[model samples]
Target chain A: MPSPALRVLTDFKRWATPLPVWSGRLHAADWPLTARHIRTQGGRLLAFWGEDRRAEESAYLVHAAFLIATGIVRTEMVVDPATAVYPSLTSIFPNALRMERALYDLLGIRATGTHDTRPWLRHAAWPADRFPLRTDFPGTDLDVAADRGYAFPPTNSPDLHEIPVGPIHAGIIEPGHFRFQVLGEEILRLEERFGYAHKGVERLFRGLDGAAGARLAGRISGDSTVAYAWSYAQAVEQVAAARVPERAQWLRALCLERERLANHLGDLGAIGNDAGLAFALTQFQALKEEFLRENQRYFGHRYLMDRILPGGVAFDLAATDIAALHGAGRALETAIGHLQEILAEHGGLRDRVVQVGVVSPERAAYLGLMGVAGRASGQAWDLRVQFPPSPYDRLQVRMAVAMDGDVAARMAVRFQEISESLRLQEEILRKLPDGHPYHPLDLREAAGEGIGWVEGWRGEVFFWLRMAQGNIRHCRPQDPSWTLWPVLEEAVLRDIVADFPLINKSFNLSYSGHDL
Target chain B: MYRILREVLRLGKVGEKPPRTQRDPASASPSCFRHSLGIRHVDAGSCNGCELELNALNGPHYNLEQAGFRFTASPRHADVLTVSGPVTRHMAAALQDCHTAMPAPRRVIAIGDCACDGGVFQGSYAVVGKVAAVLPVDLQISGCPPDPDALLRGLLRISGEQVNS
Candidate 1:
């Protein structure tokens, strides 16, 4: 299915579209049976599913085109007031089962149609039937035993062995649980049970106003702080119909591109390091540190958190900052050039990454993978280039894509993307609009719903927010990881168990992004 | 000779010792012994902020390996415990088991604002909420998730290292 942003753009191009062309906020009632529809030249459908009380009343939005165009995207929400049982979308999209069951467990919402309603995120630690996310759920007392009652599925076969790795891993990394069922060295099945690090981030937005909510949003994922904050701000602005200053929009794009470059560089280095290529790690690490230090010098936080506010950006780039960025760009170019030369000389590195984890184009399409991973697999659906919003439209963007569908392809896409980002950054610095960084937005407590779509480094970040009585009625930030995580599972199917790390790193799907 | 050249190129001039402030042996507390931390990371449901920064530490730039700290696969072999997230009901037991499995002289370093005081998940129904509620915490590094540098500093502090010196 074409992404929601594309669906919106297509709908905008249609003459017979019933909806007003430029309406920023759409009433929930006016939406189609699917909850929302944008009529463009090819028209697309947006559907909303359910809402959490912490954020908003129950609502689900889906892109019309995503359903009709592909006929693969199926979603359902069962809101049973008595048992609070929500219909499951797993039967249609097997991937949604975990999230749906998790929602059921957390929100006291049950998914009746789900096949495995196993305690996904929920274990025996909490009292049975006492849903934690419910409004009245009491906090747990410290008297609880750490291992009082928890059981993992056992594999008792003579040939088949179970390997339990982590809640803590060998590298300096986030903790997660991976239970690998293997026959001889071949992994038969892999079950990932996370939420060992559940932080209840979504519930944090309970009583926060727009500004306070934005701060919370930035913390949702630290590396993607700029993207989350910008996306949250975009959703809030869209709901309030607030117009961001042109300069702010441009700066947001610049920061996002920089974020993309920094992450890509780090990932590129790590991918090589994982494969025993120490040279790439050192080179990329140095480059990444330099990049982040520049960001810290310009913005308060190295990660650029709280820099992109709701109405506009918090900090404006002075001419000197722009000049410094240009200088940094030149340095990056030189470093990347040297690294590329080294990479070219080392053919062994190429062999390992080229076809190591191949997620065929066909599978990529079926899974609806987006972002660089999608681009690597021949799906070049970039929000910046295809659906240029504001400053992006004025400043052209050329997406980088590769059709190899392998680790090398993903790497190539990142390499190309860094060059493209540099070019775009230079253009933005040169043509930065002459104006104030922000304009005060007067947001009212009226009921309205808006979808904010931004191209985060990972992929398209979709935020569907509804405001009621001056509070966030509902806010759902859909990370592209939701779609890509399953793709990683699919990609690992035929590959060796030893190669899992390389494949997993290639995707780097955000577990936190998906859990929330 | 080639190996030396490669090492020199890989280390570059940036390896000239992380300024004296960052490298002083005195900066490490006399009592601060290098301890193997067995970290139990909870999702408690986050946006992945803490994880990303944590991930960054493993990446080349931060190169956490340089600190003599390594992430172990099992809690049984760990000395210090690191917890992320606001402590959700789902992960509460897992967090505790991880803590219980660790050997003595263990300290818990709560990384991120959420882990510190339910930073964002302050009053959510789904949250159990703060890391302190489930376990005793020795240090709190705040931010939505503290920066990797801050996280490293917190780890050093928990290990009884003198950080700023």
Candidate 2:
């Protein structure tokens, strides 16, 4: 409610951005202690990643970025190659468990004293000893046998039976495995296993220049291409010390808001369809199609991929384009209003959605739930409002919140967000700045680490990039789905197995993004 | 219900005509699939860009069902398996198993550039190359992610349709 305290004036060095970002180095011994200090001060672990810097230094570096009351605080710790282990923050932030496991799986950097030691990203695609992210290792596909010995933790209830779904779902969706422990119809426990869609995005970004890296980042998650691309560009620009033009910033905001609107429309329809309303799917899909068509007309890509390059946007809006957007926005606003009324009035849909798969605020906080799903559970954290970067700061965005923490609440948030995005788009178009869309970034002399934070349609999309001699050294793109997936597991507890589709659709976490 | 019905009536006949087949005539198809075709889509390891286009085929705009093509829930009921994304090593086995589950004389269509080749992630350690690397691909529709119209055209071509939009 209150504006974040001016800034955390600690020992951390602040980045050269209006957004509050403070970076601090931590001793290996104080890894867990520093994490506890942040946790005690009510900080949320935003992202945790490991970088292999053995060539530059003997030790592997583990970085944890946290969102405290003030702003983002990124802390780095060096892990000795001999030990190859650091203190785990799983107890402090439950979501860090998967990240720490992924760190070990990718870079052979283990997080000691963690409850779960199971592999997260490594599904026996490569040897256990061979870490792909290491400088010495080459990125080559091996014809090895798949990991068939994945052990799902027992819920300690012998009476409950297990039902495993996916890796290949009935619907046309991304791949992920879900194991559910159920008694009759009620689900007791649900464990999700992803990485089936992992295409080694981080490895692919290793040697790419700014242009190529931006393209790869866009593909990290197709649905959130605009967000990923923008965030990647922002990070690259920050590292290159390139200032994007005012018009470019506003245009980027337009692409992001449009992306948010399109996704919300699509998800709202799917959620309604999952609740037994087929009409909603058809109507919403049509609306979403129209929205995307406009994007193609103006931005040149249906999903706005490759539109946000390193320095600025790929395409600029013409007079006709601006007029067309205004027309489309009005039509969309009317359609969305009608759909909202229909959804609100539909009793059967309401009965199916309301109070189903409830993730209480306490449970949400404990699991570090974030993004649209988090806001529904009373996590009043929207990056657009809290730490607005450029155009978002100018937009004065409204944060959407709900307390029920149910499927209805998530749906409500989506609808409200759609309205807000439409409003934002109208404002962006009305006060469209006049300048070149691109600034022509020359990364020949660029050599530094920078962080990019964008409030994507789903939630906050964070990118951490380190450039060395104009090429990407280490890049980490963290999707909000990382935290929300576990929250889905918690939300499904005690709910009927049949309602899983509806609840999951409401959350709508990305498989490729999470897996990557 | 009344509101929905009224809304549907108001937006009447919005479906577009089926796009013409881009497939070569030499690629023969079984006569039984001439009238109707059932497809099962397997996302081996895609960015979900192709999946979005494929999903758009079912919307009111494209409405592939009117052209006698439908997405089946089970592989057993499918005559075509539409695969997307470069096949990840993790999903390679599942993809093969899915192909194995389909009935005889089933065609495999790889949608998007990623499914055709590896696209951007061609040489990644996690990837197992394209759909053809894992399964016998009959058709490869190329694009970063083929548009819905292209996706529909690909489906109809495999089903032996030469219809025009």
Query: What TM-score would each prediction reach against the true structure?
Result: 0.82, 0.97
The TM-scores that each candidate's chain B achieves against the reference are 0.78, 0.92
True contacts kept of 2: 0.75
State the lDDT of candidate 1 residue by residue for A368-387, as single tens digits. Answer: 66788999999878877776
Model 1 chain A: lowest-lDDT 10 consecutive positions: A15-24
Index of the highest-lDDT prediction: 2
Error of 2 at A452 (Å): 0.5
Q: For candidate 2, what is the DockQ-based docking class?
A: medium
Candidate 1's residue-wise lDDT over B1-165, tens digit each? 354366457556663222122333543223434533444444444556676677666555554556656666666766667777777655676677778877776777787777888776676555666788889887788886577777777776655555664
The per-prediction i-RMS, to one decimal, reads 4.8, 1.3
- Which stretches of model 1 miss by more than 4 angstroms? A1-48, A52-94, A107-114, A125-157, B1-11, B16-79, B148-165
Per-residue accuracy of model 2 over B85-129 as CA lDDT, tens digit each: 989988888899999999988999999989898899898989988
What's the DockQ for every one of the candidates? 0.39, 0.75
- Write out the backbone clash pairs for model 2: none
Model 2 misplaced regions, further than 4 Å? A1-10, A138-141, A155-158, B20-25, B163-165
Could you tell me how far off, in angstroms, the CA of residue A233 lies in candidate 1 after the best superposition?
1.3
